[model samples]
Target: MLGIQNLSLFIASGLLLNVIPGPDSLLIMARSATQGWRAGSAAALGVGAGTMMHVLAAAAGLSALLATSAAAFAIVKWVGAAYIVYVGIALLRSKPGKAAAPAALPPQPYRRIFLQGFLTNVLNPKVAIFFLAFVPQFISADAPSKPLALVVLGCVFNFNGMLWCHALAVFTAFASQRMRLKPRVTAWLSRLTGGLFIGLGLKLALSKPN
Candidate 1:
């Protein structure tokens, strides 16, 4: 059906990949821990939206350009790295009130959080390359429409990823509630996450095109 092959294997592989810790998962978890589940869901949805862009790009064969063109790849990579670093710095600079309740801690506009998640996924040229390389395996050669096949495969992967991301958000929020972390402790967690983001951003910046 739809020129798809080994779909079970593809879905299994996608699930495993989604479980691996990455910027997408980290952003969702961080938002859930600091804000509530709703905020986490916003981030998760934003990520899903970003995945749709990649899916469309893949269907249009734009990803192939990113995979082959050094200049295009470098431009996107630097922009993505810079954005991630900027977000991390903002988190590091944020200071929550010592007495603020978990609910009372300053709330970032959910729209901004959503945009953060969207850019986090969409701006990474590596993601486009990964889709170009990975999504094709399950699509049969000589498919009726190669572009349609790519879209189907990309949508499946994104759906599975969204499920995992939302689950992570819920779980993180639940665990944080259980622990009842103090405001000071939450602040420290935020800072730690910020540092991790910085490290991840630098790593991405330094990454060689593959």
Candidate 2:
């Protein structure tokens, strides 16, 4: 168990970020609504996977390396940015039509869905570097269990991320049902999401390193 203070802060941060709409959350909503639970969950898994990568990199000291080294940071940033842009384009080309619903869609291969989740997280350099930077501030710089504490912090982040995204996926699933009756809205929303992803990628690509 985390120290009371750490747990409290972790929950607070998670809840705050969870509520704020972002690319990952939006992607889950868009995919889940259109592709049903499986697809939405696939996106959710992606986010979680991305989270794991950040935590792992932080644990492995990659984040710290990137932090002090400008070239390394830029490399991560560009790679991550490009990946997001690629996903956004793929989504745009993917049919906006409701191909399946929770009830109507065939059971998605859970293993693959889970793997997709892992990959999504793994490919996101922003999340990776962000986690690298974010965790240390909360930990005591001189703590004996700094590495252990970081691992715990990463776990907290992953759990919170998954829980929040899953909740959104459920919400989006219902919303998708309602939207099936309104194809125009779905189409417009899909375009908006695609645009958002691309914009975010571009912004991230150009953003100065911390």
Identify the leading candidate in terms of TM-score.
1
Expressed as tens digits, the lDDT of each residue in 11-116 for candidate 1 is: 9999998899878887888899889887888899988998889999988988988888888888988999998888778667766655546532357789988998
Error of 1 at 34 (Å): 0.9
Score every model by TM-score.
0.96, 0.82
User: Of the candidates shown, which would achieve the greatest lDDT relative to the real structure?
Assistant: 1
Which regions of candidate 2 deviate over 4 angstroms?
1-5, 94-120
Taking the tens digit of each residue's C-alpha lDDT, what string does model 2 give over 112-176? 55554555456556666677776777777566677778888888878887888888888888776
RMSD of 2: 3.5
Poorest stretch of ten by lDDT in candidate 2: 98-107
